[model samples]
Target: MQACANWIDGGPQPSRADQWLDVTNPATGAVIARVPLSTAEEVEQAVQSAERAFADWGCWPPVERARVMFRFQQVLRDHFDELARLIVEDNGKTLAEAKGSVQRGIEVVEFAAGIPSLGMGDVLKDIAPGVDCEMIRQPLGVVAGFTPFNFPVMVPLWMIPIALACGNTFVLKPSERAPLAGLRIAELFAECGAPPGTWNVLHGTARVAEQLMADPRIQAVSVVGSSPIA
Candidate 1:
């Protein structure tokens, strides 16, 4: 069976984990692949990688960052059909549903590509005599996202593109049951010429998420799941 790998530092890497969980196709009882139950140390590595990249990535102008999103948008379009297929394979969504989900993800990327305008700060000239006030936006150092099994591609896209466009480095923990779409998307993002360590993915169970939430290095976290999981 195929073994899924983690995307770290702009490329795929074998997990250090000694244990793994099977990723089965929902439509059938077949084990399509195995995903690592990534260790806490591995999770830390992902966080540290994002933290290191933040120094440079966070300094990029919003327009330049948006340009990366634009390239990513194009790359996603180039592989649109493939992404839809991956979603169908991993999540067992119908071909039409998978296509719709992928399209929704692409739309988010399109919105992220416009962050140059959307993320602009505001300035108010002289409310009081000779005084001015301004609000400027800045990137937090590192952010993480936890996505559920359903709508794998769309959920991760909801967080990854916007966060990166806003200049925050990201570490994503995709659902163990359906992780391929997110991993493939990370590869496409790297091809868009994003710097190494700017985006990373780790596959595991809930413990990985706990590690993310407990870590001081993660400046923010986004989770899509049930109320208890949230």
Candidate 2:
């Protein structure tokens, strides 16, 4: 059942505040679990953690970050079954579709694991007299992502691993309709050697998503949804 009763952070009880949201299995329309809905204040705490993590995380060497991503990808594959189950239960997708969705998400980690290539630098040949020009890819401070219900695991992958590899810490806002799946990824990120505050998760609706985007702490925002919704 994933024990949505708690959110995963550096350890257990990842959420702050008294507000909570119930999770139902869209497939069967049964109450699956209860997830603590993080208030704006609580969300700020996560942003602070991620912001604090950025100073060092932004300086993390590409190869070192790649190592963590490697282990992360392997671990995700190790728990593929569990991840697939949650997707199917929460999304009401056929079990096979859920598994495929998770598989695609796992592949994103793999793609991101090649950080050296993914985090490429730019080169400029002789911008002036005997002066070599170049630009290095660096972290973009704290990035917040709002993942949609269509693909809980997949949407998060679109941001977290890539952003972390680029040395940017993350705050994830998963859809309230199917939120626990994003929280689960936070647990995996920690397990993957993502430093405390390097990644955080919160659940909510448009209000929460807007809160994330509007926060100055979040330097960048990735809103995932269909074109029509936008």
Clashes of 2: 0
RMSD, each candidate, Å? 1.2, 2.5
Best by lDDT: 1
Residue 117 of candidate 2: its Cα lDDT? 83
* lDDT of all predictions: 0.90, 0.78
Predicted candidate 2 versus true structure: per-residue lDDT over 173-215, tens digit per residue: 7777787677777787787776788887766656667777778
Estimate the lDDT of model 1. 0.90
Q: Which numbered prediction scores highest in TM-score against the true structure? A: 1
Report lDDT (Cα) of residue 207, candidate 2: 66
**Residue lDDT tens for model 1, 75-158:** 999999999999988999999999999999999999999988898899999989999999998888899999998998999999
Clashing pairs in 2: none
